[model samples]
Target: MNVVTRSAGIFLLAMAAIALPGCRPASQPSGQIITLRLSGWQSNPNEKQRLDYLLRKFEKTHPTIQVKYETINSEYMDVIKTRLIGDVAPDVFYLDGFEAPLLMQYQVLEPLDRYITPEFNLADFEPSLLNAFRYRNQLYGLPKDFSTLALIYNKQALAAAGITHPPKTWAAFTVAARKLTVDRNGDGKIDQYGFGIAPELARQTFMIKAFGGQLVDQNGFATFAAPNSLRGLELIVNQYRRDRTAAQPTDVGATWGSEMLGQGKAAMVIEGPWSIPYFKETFPALEFGTAEVPAINGKPGTMAYTVAYVMNRKTRHKEAAWKLIAYLTGKEGMKAWADQGLALPARRSVLGELGYDKNTLYAPFVAGARYATIWQAGKHLPTIRMNFNNQFISALLGEQPLSDAMQRAQDTANREISWAN
Candidate 1:
């Protein structure tokens, strides 16, 4: 059967499974617990505390069911994939929206529609974000938290450069970056850079979209060779080569852009809302503010990354698993998590409750959600990313022309997709 038909079949089977008596294991002498495993990557101390509190509440509400939480410390995605392939995956686990398409294509995730009740209210989530986890009309995941990119700048750096506010247009940004960049000690060695760009798939994907370029076409083919896309790549490379105002975090062995900015080595960077809390805890003395990512060619844009709680297709305890998923994503759980203000809430009402709608620091990020381009999750995402990285780095090093590099990257990515098919 085709994908949609197969998805429908799965949904029907799930419904049948839920409806039939004896679907769950024997009631364990009426009082024993029904244990389920929930897995996710590591979280901060505060987040862990909150999760523990929520889990305790869940256990109290459903005394018969017990959840065993597990964590993978290293190579989380690889570990999760290996477990899924080995048929030992957790009943419920964290799934990034970008990876949902791949998991759905492999038919490894359970369709959630069968379990969603009237109380679930799937419509409460942002439609575009919810659509990210839905494949062939079957929802595979429910978003728990989300983040969008914004320009984070040092107030002192801008003042020293005679700038009063963050730049709003590409032209103004370029000017400010040049002025803010300096060889501070005048020893011909640059002590401070105007900006640092994180040289990763996520940041580059945002750059491509900001310039009105689609990384993949409607048919799920790589399409980064368009002129607009090439211009976007050029903009990044030129900042390092021509403007001399930007450097990649890798050049300094920093894993994230936020770290580069936190150290006071860079005056500006584009990062997500998560960085705010991270910096607040890591370096309370640093002074900074966030602004919407400057428009490129007069268009507002940014990149949004989100993760959802999903069920495994092979989960034997479907009912118990649904209950756990529901509680984690429900109004109560969402409010508890979002109240910490570490990440943006995926639910609309929870965002308002958390004061994100009125907080000026968070308002731009929420506003950008409507225009932000989401990362793609085509079957060939891994291969496409590899090629894009290689070619992008080559352009950054002046080893190839922007157009030539992008064309070669596109060709390589398309070939990989063809091989996969």
Candidate 2:
């Protein structure tokens, strides 16, 4: 027999040794219950509670299987990679689009196409989200959730500045930002800046593409330093340094863009749906509005982030793992999870059922989904991201010219990628 057949036979034997026939599902051999391991990071305590509740419901339906869920709070990717190399990784785990390419390329994830059934309605998922987890025509993951950036503005702040609506174009946005900036007490230091900025590759990537620039060339080497890309990036640097109307989180003693906006440190921020619930819970009285990100170079653009449930290739209980993946990513399950409004559902039906597209608070995010750039480049993205962020901040601080900073970053990232290859 072939290696695959032999492995299947051994897996059956192992199951037979542990499974109890009486409780086994109708299709599988009678055996004792199987326990599957799952790992992921929790964004908040409520998210963990919601997942635990869902897992309980899943268990009630599939009595023959049990899932042990674990949370990796820090350095999640590093920990997962170590566990994978040691052959002790969870049967299934969360995979971000940014990290999917590397694991998919390494052959560490199981191709999920074989397990997908017509009844599962794989076509219900958003094509862009699904494409993030595909590698070489094989589906390695099923996107569980996604989010796209939108311009989140404080209503009172906008009105105070005499702006009746959010800016629709880059030129207008800059003007609005300058108008909103104020030194309320004549203390020489601005009390409320017009915009809060995030100086990271993930947020700036869409800007790079706004002017027909690419993040990586055909060979997956860094190309973000090209002239066209710099033009878009220069807009951000100028807003912060020359216009002096934008501030990074550090400038306002905030940890992130959401916090910067929430505390009234800034009037606007580019964030995703996750900020909706955050504002309601943490800043309940803060009146806010959402709008599609301003057009750059006469083109609408924003960033989309997604995560998927991927099974480990070496999982011994392939059948059980597949069942769990299908259940979690299924329409019913997705709706339950997305009802929290923390993230957008990946399935078109679930998103529609949730009414996010029609809800004024969430419509901008939903609209941007149609054209947002998926936040992924290649397997070397982590390396490229680190180099870009380090130098990009230097440029934003005026320590170096934007062009020189980007050039240094590009050269350093490509050098590191070459060494790895």
Candidate 3:
């Protein structure tokens, strides 16, 4: 069998092992039922439904353990921090890649290296994704789901514009976008835009990387003011002003790329796997396809957002908590989650079994995995995001030049980094 097929076979074997009766370790059960609290931000109705099912299955398999689910609706990080300080934190919680560094620095999370078993096959996860949760070579969390950016386009819109396929280069992309934009009613107002670009830290960060700009220096100092970085920033702003074919999410009060594309207000967007299920459910009538993100000056690029399951350092039930985490992130649970097509799996083996390799809508996302840039994790991410968001929004409003805005953002981010140090 080929490498992918072989990996899939191994993953199936692992799942079988997890599903077998009496798969728990030989250590004696405490004989007392334990209740574990798990918490995370709710994404959508589908995610909640899947999680409820998984939790119920876990409860059935381990009769001695009861799981309680809680969600913080406002300011997730702040609420989680407050609860941790109050000594009432959940036993397990979702940790975003950008926030992991801050939490790890505060010594709030328990390192999970001790709980890793040979059967867990940590090597199965992408090394880059796994590195996000590591502190001094000690693993702290296991990735649950990951997302990578891809070009999502409306097939009908492309056909109407006389374009045979999505653009492959930035030059062609601009041309196609201009062609697709229309003032359909002769009201001198553009009714359809070719693209929807969100003006936010995450999107800008990805752009900077696409143009070969690093957000931080070797010592983790902010470096977004570099010339190439400014060039990258100008590329998107120019597309908005010069071409008039792109609209920001704020232009339509749409919070995300999927919504704008779903409404047919935008013909194309750069989004992640999460939008797949959202589109399938929210706008079932719309026909769309995805391609790898267009090359920037001949170099392919995209962004990745990942989250992991982490344990509380002060939890009284470390052993039981680890068991639950292992099972949830193991081959069985990971396969089940990925199979639902809600999000891409972090493991290579699971992706094959789910047929993501041959799936045209999902193949670009998978192909971009190796080249996609992961969001930076550090003690200053929160501050950096705040500074970038403010300046980027100003640039988007045409109040400042892209160069000036990026320089100011870099300076402000550096000051925050200095203060933290």
Candidate 2 vs 3: which has more TM-score? 2
Name the regions of candidate 3 deviating beyond 4 angstroms.
Answer: 1-29
* Superposed model 1: Cα runs more than 4 Å off: 1-32
Lowest lDDT block of 10, candidate 1:
18-27
Q: TM-score, each model?
A: 0.90, 0.93, 0.90
TM-score of predicted structure 1: 0.90
Candidate 3, residue 174: the lDDT equals 88
Error of 2 at 370 (Å): 0.9
Kindly list the per-residue Cα lDDT of model 3 for residues 269-371, writing each as its tens digit: 9988788888998999999999998898789888888899998887778887887888778878888767767678888888887889799989999998898
Instruction: Extract clashing residue pairs from model 1.
Output: none
* Candidate 1 lDDT score at position 213: 83
Residue pairs whose backbone atoms clash in candidate 3: none
lDDT accuracy of residue 411 in candidate 3: 87
Top candidate by lDDT: 2
How many pairs of residues in model 3 come into backbone collision? 0
